[model samples]
Target: MAEHPAYPVGLRLAGRRVVVLGGGQVAQRRLPALIAAGADIHLVSPQATPSVEAMADAGEIAWTRRPYEDGDLADAWYALIATSDQGANTAASAEAERHRVWCVRSDDADAATAWTPATGHSEGVTVAVLTTDARGRDPRHTAAIRDAVVEGLRDGTLVAPHHRTRTPGVALVGGGPGDPDLITVRGRRLLAEADVVIADRLGPRDLLAELPPHVEVIDAAKIPYGRYMAQEAINNALIEHAKQGKSVVRLKGGDPFVFGRGMEEAQALAEEGIACTVVPGISSSISVPGAAGIPVTHRGVAHEFTVVSGHVAPDDERSLVDWPSLARLTGTLVILMGVDKIGRIAETLVAHGKPADTPVALVQEGTTAAQRRVDATLATVAETVREQDVKPPAVIVVGEVVNVGVQSSPKTSE
Candidate 1:
């Protein structure tokens, strides 16, 4: 099989007609890119995810509730077939070729006209990672590689190809969980260049002081549990300032991609054809435990770690996770935004065969000067949290590794 070719220059698919023939999670994931590229998207699928249905209901894209037909390729500049059915995907790819449209077949690696690279964007520049083998690898591996590249850029070890002739604009970075010193070097540089700074309520205030005094500051901050500006308004403000050619920073608390809604803002900017880049930050899920003297993974203690959100919809049962596998695994489990659901979560874990006596720890304001740690067992974590006043912007770590902190910490002044 022939390998896919890498493009010397990334194509800006703005204002193109892109047809996506699937409505599953994979299709839903790809839709954002097409929408962000300002494509006139025509979706053909027998079923749709909530996100897809929402977009279609809002009239954001044209939708056909059926499988792809030959006529579905009419006037499309690009086509993506992401159905679970391999035969359906092959047929769609064949149709795309007949219409001379650029095509990507999710199931058939050799049939794609172009491969979707693991992309990272900053300002107008886009860095894409393309494996030599066109066969799409596992997403978990792809994510790991993307993370490594992002970390390299953050630390200045991976210097992207820069046209020094063009000065880059400011990037708003999520400094991650807490530790002020944990701020990425790229984030620090952007802070230095920022003509204006807008930050979230949870971000370390001391980190903001690092900026030059001449820089204007705005406190359009939002707390996870507090009132704040809607994300749409925030997106508009960021673009409006950038459109004025002013370097602006809209800093968040943690890694922007991990539940920070960074992709939504990125999509909004892409829709307007405004170039913006995302600088990934350390997520609290792993870092918080590390700061609390707990390693997420330890030999013979934990072999895997699963990170999940606690605030998913109740009616959306799909969002609810498999507590049994998580409980049975000999690994660490971290839950974010789950303080309120601690009781129910504990019940589920216990019912699913996790020992009621399994160690659990709640680390609040992690990585900051005012950090606090509350230790308890699976049976008593909910009560312990209430007694200790553990709050949001915190991480709940459950597993054998949770005992590491208790054993390591010496008695200190309360």
Candidate 2:
């Protein structure tokens, strides 16, 4: 007769006793899972690694400070034997079997009744990959298969029908930087289900090209001019489509709230009695700099980073930016939409307390295939921008942190 399947069941060990033998590497790894299961864990070992010792100090687990014995299994609902000594493993398994408690043996799986599977957690789902082991699990080449499935799970590629339901509402999704793959899982899934997509100039345009032919794609860039007029039209379009009982996706570049005018749309929809949901995207202010191998904030060099818009020149009366205040800040300063006014912005910073020799970096078309970086100083950045012929949709970083991550020009800001 074949042994009963080791019952692939999840144990509610919470508030129940769980025993772990040996305080070495084996126990170190198993204890975390046991702890996560809310089990009352007992560690039986005279010596333990510093990490285990730290856990004990924090009262996360009970340390017996002695070797395992038969009595240890008396109250344990589950046990794991990870001692290097085979005799100790055998002894613990024997005790657990007599008590009808399942025990896992790290030294010899064939002799054990329970096996630990490779596990991963994504979203709200917990996945366990059981390779063919003594417990009749598949072990022959599951790594590649496991990775592919897990990737699909994370990117929402295997979204269910319910997830893509054609509900009448507006989903304001922030496409991270310019990478199609950087969009959030929920954002990508919503895009697939969108009846109409209102796309921004800097959004992940590549992803839009892959949308179904039936999906209506509205190019926000071509919308008529005047800032207020353009935004009002976008808002009206979202409300109009959603009211028509169709799902509308207001796709914007970077994060919707981070200078993307997302809140304005949300407020507009609310006043119109239309349902609106927000799906935040990865902001280029941080990710763009990172892709260029520059740390916006580093330990000793820069403790903070400030992201602001340079679309309005500092000399312009309409510009609300306090250039003097920004210049006084010793931390990194990141400017978005500032390519057109970089000369004035740099000049203002220098005229203020900021050093003329401060390292400056202009990253154009950041986080995209055409991404390019040109290094200069605050004093000569305008000339560099002209020399490099840099254009809009760029990120300007001014600080010492840029120097730490990558090699900067010996050129002075003066």
Best by TM-score: 2
| TM-scores of the models, in the order given | 0.57, 0.82
lDDT of 2 by residue, 297-341 (tens): 988889889999998999999898889999999899999999989
Assess each prediction's global lDDT (C-alpha) against the native: 0.77, 0.84
- Model 2's lDDT to the true fold? 0.84
What's each prediction's clash count?
A: 3, 4
For candidate 1, the lDDT comes to 0.77
| Clashing residue pairs found in predicted model 2 | 131-138, 132-137, 132-138, 132-139
